[model samples]
Target: MELGACPKSMRYGPCGGVRTGGGCEVVDEPCPFVGRPLVEWAGTELAPRAIELPRFLVDHRPTGDDRVDRQVLDDYAASGVAVLLGDHLDDPPAVDRVAAAERTVDAGVPTIATITGRDRSTDERAEMIDGLLAAGVAAVLCVTGDHPSARFTAHPDVTFVSEGTLLAGEVRSRGGRVAVAESPAAEPTRQRAARLVEKQRAGADIAVLNHSGPVADVIAFAEQASALGCRLPMYAPVPVMTDLASMAALEQFPGLTIADDAVNAMHTSSDPFSTGLDLAVAMAGELLGSGSIAGVNLSGVATSGGAVERGRVMRRVVDAVTA
Candidate 1:
């Protein structure tokens, strides 16, 4: 391959996205900086991995924010959160998710509401879409809601809902940007690849990987999807590793991955918060650089401060990488 162009910031600065495995995050190639006698390679060797900053989103937990809406919105907005995501957390009458998204839009930030394809009747599902449209929600992620058994076994938030593909088709016909979730891919299989293609054929604009796992999983899924003829824009989910308890919770959630190394690092590090932050930066940089991925969604239960700080740092990394 020809030498890719580099930015001034990276031309002479330390490369933070250099993986612990010693691979260049900007390119899938070996770290050119490693064992190189040429000093300029430190700055100019790896061309900027991205031509533009990918879409960065903050996944906000569901809140009865009549209590803290203003503070939450202001905090996220100030923290440089570019997009807001309100999950269809376990709550009665999944339609409530649309209202949750409405609250996000009311905050003046673009938001995405996750709608489940179960629980409600067909009319209810359509009404939910109408509610989001009327509320001016910028986007919606239609998901095949959790199974009924999950409510009792998992966090109280799991619930079955409508079909995600049908929801995406409806949202598209109504002119709302729509997304769907994919999962369980440290290793990709044909079944998973075919499902992704089916979802895209159903009108999903973006394929949001369902787990908070390693960047490799996302890349692997993308490659498999491409091989299967699924052209959906792929968006990887990044975890907000604050408390170990919350981080560990991801393991129980189906379709998400929290690698053992990550788990161990967060558990053993003197400052787990910074350690997790570095991991997020590295993963986001890798995903952004990998041309297969369209963007990333930062997901976790974090304070508005934590969420904002995550976005700020990731944005800086993007700025530097694409500088």
Candidate 2:
């Protein structure tokens, strides 16, 4: 497939959002990178390794409301887990990421900020990374974000100047820690591990695996990546949905697949809140006990006004895993 055929124009080929049947997430065609040879990293030297992340990493989104966002940060600080801050597709408005990171750092929480190559030029992304690091974030997650939907019609003609691989190098060049993502369940599953190897060569210090099908899938992906010479510390995502609203929000995430049994448990149980929390703890324990992954990321979202409750659920999972 031609590079020009890809909507994201990614030098790294297929991203994590490729549909189950090998279709592009942005268009109704097969992914250009599908059935193509794995793209090898052209660079010679790898980025210097950064500091190792904590055992428990939780996803967080600042709602652009100071009071609500501060309460979330304080919860994470007290829970003793690192917070990975990024843009949620359904966020109210774009928060000042640098300011959020500063607040998180001030609250004594380890912070990892995400920089996406979506609607932002290369120079603009560079500025974001510098600002995040300056605000004392522990690392930067470089990603080729999901293509903008109709809600983002304002920038209909936005250009993607850098994909995750290029942005990983940018983060390392500035002496910032770099984390990259891979989808083990996306199309070209056999090549997903190789793709992560290429990202590692491009200077990624860590790999955060997307929500694949099950814990077994994550373990298999980790094994393949390790065999293909990927040595970065890897974190697997565990969905944390305590209610239908949270579950619905997570289901909207592109390319993420929660296990069928877990989903059914949440949908059919009389009390979804308790059922969801229990399922999360079980899944996290299984992933960590597999010994294939370095850690587990509590990955999900909350309804409006449900952030604190969701954080409490995540904290319970952390405690169970540590206990």
Candidate 3:
């Protein structure tokens, strides 16, 4: 497969390159950072994250089965996109949907399932993860979730659940990839640094940042993670929802102040949907250009024609960065 203008050496393949026919070929070169401004970032003391597109393709699908909308799943596969299944626990329906969607999409790319503390008991969450693994859901993202219980009624003060270390151990024991969430805006830089360390210690395979801030802040957080010996890939989730839903998610949630800042920081139309997508795309451009961000995840956004439009935007960012 010709990688267009991208250099063969920088081209990544699946499985982070292997010694298949040659000694070591990049099976999946997430993105290019070498010769980029990454070196100047914090004096080169940070982990360069892979260029990933972790998208929410089928959120709260109908039919209560594990099956996602076939068209939705297919679009993800066709576009080289990965789906992060929704946040439903306790209801076997939600858990089953992950597997069904994976099978339905058959995209052959990596897929992740989200595990939230509010959704299931600790044991139940573990079982749900196990089911995801059995169904080929190797990657898992652990979050505090939106509510105290699966009912979405309560809002706890602190929601950073999954005890990063324990969850990573669980996934690793099962030989699966595990990811955790991070927010530069969640706490003081020092505290965020400590939490990142804790997550790394928990055997997290990657870190998915919740909020997007200045390039300096982004680089600082990435640097801090590296200082702690966390080479795990890092990602940023860009919300692409209708303006109203995006605004609601931002305004309603106590921790969504960052999203509000993101909205305020941008100079776009007042319309939420257009504003969200435009801002998401712009932030994505910055992330890709940073050379420190590994990849991006698309969330809080609705799909268009069964496809995650952000993936296409990401491709443009990747091309620009690599070029």
Clashes of each: 9, 0, 18
TM-score on alpha carbons, each prediction: 0.70, 0.94, 0.64
Clashes of 3: 18
Q: Looking at candidate 2, what is the lDDT of residue 13?
A: 72
Q: Rank the candidates by TM-score, best first.
A: 2, 1, 3
Over 276-305, each residue of candidate 1 has an lDDT whose tens digit, in order, gives 777767777788888988887776653234
Off by over 4 Å in 2: 150-157, 302-305
Model 2 pairs whose backbones collide = none
Name the candidate that leads on lDDT: 2
The most accurate candidate by TM-score is 2
- Where does model 1 exceed 4 Å of error? 1-54, 87-95, 154-161, 186-188, 303-323
Residue range with the least summed lDDT across 10 consecutive positions in model 3: 11-20
RMSD for all candidates, in order, please: 15.2, 2.0, 15.3
The TM-score, computed over Cα atoms with residue i paired to residue i, of candidate 3 is: 0.64
Better model by lDDT, 2 or 3? Answer: 2
Task: Choose 1 or 2, whichever is better by TM-score.
Answer: 2
Candidate 3 C-alpha error for residue 6, in Å: 50
